[model samples]
Target: MSLAWNASTDNVGVTGYGVYRGGTLVTTVTGTSFTDTGLSAGTAYTYTVRARDAAGNQSANSNQITATTSGGGGDTTAPSVPGNLRSTGVSSSSVSLAWNASTDNVGVTGYGVYRGGTLVTTVTGTSFTDTGLSAGTAYTYTVRARDAAGNQSANSNQITATTTTGGGGGGKKVLGYFVQWGVYQRAYHVKNIDTSGSAAKLTHINYAFGNVQNGQCTIGDSNADYDRFYSAAESVDGVADTWDAGALRGNFNQLRKLKQKYPNLKVLFSFGGWTWSGGFGQAAANPAAFAESCYRLVEDPRWADVFDGIDIDWEYPNACGLTCDTSGPASFRNLMSALRARFGSGNLVTAAITADGTSGGKIDAADYGGAAQYLDWYNVMTYDYFGAWAAQGPTAPHSPLTSYTGIPQAGFHSDQAIQKLKSKGVPASKLLLGIGFYGRGWTGVTQSAPGGTATGPAPGTFEQGIEDYKVLKTRCPATGTIAGTAYAHCGNQWWSYDTPSTIGGKMGYSKDQGLGGAFFWELSGDTTNGELITAMRNGLG
Candidate 1:
């Protein structure tokens, strides 16, 4: 078929055209245009089409049309350089790098990541993780955008990031679990942690509270009566009196001493637990008074230097805890806003929340997503899905990684809890995975590992409940793996606890999901050598 030009712009009424390549005429046609076939692959050909009239007069060629045949479409443009590069506050052996999305003319398909002038990875993502680098070493990175046509854009501005010093060998994310004091004293149950090895792996040691009592801070010695109100109720089925100021100062002084010993540790006073959560509704009602009381309690001149931040552990507001508070969800956001304004940005504010992944759980608790904007991180209490309370025919997994064939609760697993929070717009980096140092079990079991049943609640030392993970790891080992978690049965007792192998699996999941890190209930429950903690740290690597 003869090629026809749409229109002729030259001085000649084009009758025919000559197609020339590299100073040689490739074809001549009677029509205004000609098509040249049989072009070699990957070969560059410069062509000019000259129009000739019926008088044999020719016109200068239109702008030269230089085309290159392709073996395949090769990308010539490098990726757009990454922008808004930032470094994390506490660096470890390896550093995380993230940037804004790159742009391309043909639609960006992926990215070529470079570290210190060397290509590290070609990721189809805006972020790339660089591992195996020396701690405290500085790294310079540049990213380029790749289009569908395989062409890449020029490199964007180079951004530099530095790794932190003194991580435990490999590029593991080090998360130090700060045990809330008094929950586990220096006893074998939750106390004996190996301080020597902990220093190298730990990034922060969080001391539970500075104020005593389950909830209230006794103003004076008269408050001694309220010291163990909740624990007393558990023992003596009676309601305890409020704040007897007598023992308040002594407990504060004791906290001061503990802080003196661990200077590098961060002491955070956590207010509100299961029993003491009643006052939060009232406190949350009056944001100004609550903020004032918190400031005075945490910032007391005597222990001002001792505390680094304040953690709000309101068990459940507007929902049921040991008691229920009707202070609507907005109350939580208001309280946190006042606290953030009063405490300013320097102090850290965090909260412990239930892992109930249902709509009721979200409404029962205050505005967690709203509060997230004010707080640094939201710690999801992922454990305690199944416990002695569910004393029944079919046994349940306490801290299941995923939903199994017969999970006790429909979406009560750790994975569900985390995903629920993420779906609410809470960044993964700001969410801390909760790990229980204790295990929940039942007596009169039948099935073997991970899938056994008990007729009643398992007996504990002080309470007829759960035992620490340290004890269960040795006492009862799992026979089978359940959703990357473990459970076992020995004799008439069924136990569930995370082993090093299972922990390793969970850690991989956490990293793949881009989570911040893991935190356990109390430190004292770990082995003297900190074996479980080490497993968590190493697994994070």
Candidate 2:
């Protein structure tokens, strides 16, 4: 038979290629490419080709080729790491990135790009474009090169990029509450009130009720509760809490103290929460009296000069809250109109409304959109949408962005509430996103992640199913994002809450949606160092 060699260089003429089995030379073939027959199936073989001359001289062996006659091929070498990763273009909605080519021992196949720990795209080329991102969003990206054998290289150095802030300047602003529930004042309650650190990164502080009189609404008293409350109140305004003492004389003095302590801070008096909602109906019944009562309560001659504004937390005006109110929607408008008429534009006027986005729950309860015209901002209580009230099933998301498959509730997400308010003609710039200081979770969840249902809300130390952000961030770090929100899970226990990373994303969403800003439930729930609040401040910036 004629002998041949595959591109072999030698002094000898091409003769044949040697096929080896178990390190032993088996047969010699004339053709450069030989199909060895009569070989056992699924056996390993090592082959090397050599050139032989007509004079019977054999040359040294060529490169060795090892093959496992099995069902599939195997690759032992990994692809190269992608290089020169750089952002090509950036915008509010998209970012384009490019990288240098990667080489593998066998061959390079493709590259994968990750944004903020998410696998954004896989491309066969060196560049990939990621879109559908929120404006003003900060993204960290990494690239990996893959080979045909499915071998992947280690990720390249991460590249951080941020989207544009956009041209439309108006966005939402959140007004957080500073509920001084008589804890920070008394040395005993001071133990309960954790001021071991500085104040949280909050835009506004609505100091809880300034009322101190035992029955007559007087300010200063020797009683412990009365004394602590009065002193605390007075410290904020730099004057004694003198009740029945005109606006500027009493509360205004406290305002001055607070202003002096936090020069950049804005102080607003929250009229009625759950405890004080009873008087709202009567106040709503008579708009002038309601306005006058608030005017006197807020603008008391003792310290009227110090207060910058008033915040009405009526719980629910037309709808039942801590107490039921028969007054209709128009009554809320009347009360707000009176307040606006009395306080005028120079003073800030805002309200904390229910998070219920249902037509009847919030819209029918009061003409909130109509009242918006009379106020500078409206705080949408975007939490407490779900709890242990419903029948036992999946532990629902307290603040969902949109409806998704298998979602227990149809319209209970934060996005739905905001959209509902906007549909009612409220401007996005005046709407503040409400974030809960705590997380609601359920125990006995068999699934590993957020969408799974729990037997019921899990038990908590202080409260059932609700834990502060400080605890949850350490207990359950959010790992996934759904509809722009973040959630996490641990064996049989699932928690849905926001982290700094998630908050950053939400801040981008707020900027993209033209919303004002963010507002958390309260300051005390945050960590002593105010880590979460710092994230909010930096994320907003």
Candidate 1 weakest lDDT stretch, 10 residues = 217-226
* Predicted candidate 2 versus true structure: per-residue lDDT over 60-147, tens digit per residue: 7767766655443467687878887876545466555767788998987667777776555455556554656777888889998876
lDDT of model 2 at position 237: 33
TM-score of 2: 0.60
lDDT of each: 0.63, 0.63
- Model 2 lowest lDDT segment of ten: 212-221
Candidate 1 residue lDDT tens string, 202-314: 55455453332422342322222124333322221222323555433323333344445545545566666665677777776678778877888778775576566777777
lDDT of 1: 0.63
TM-score, per-candidate, Cα-based: 0.60, 0.60
Candidate 1's C-alpha runs over 4 A off are 1-196, 209-264, 363-365, 449-452
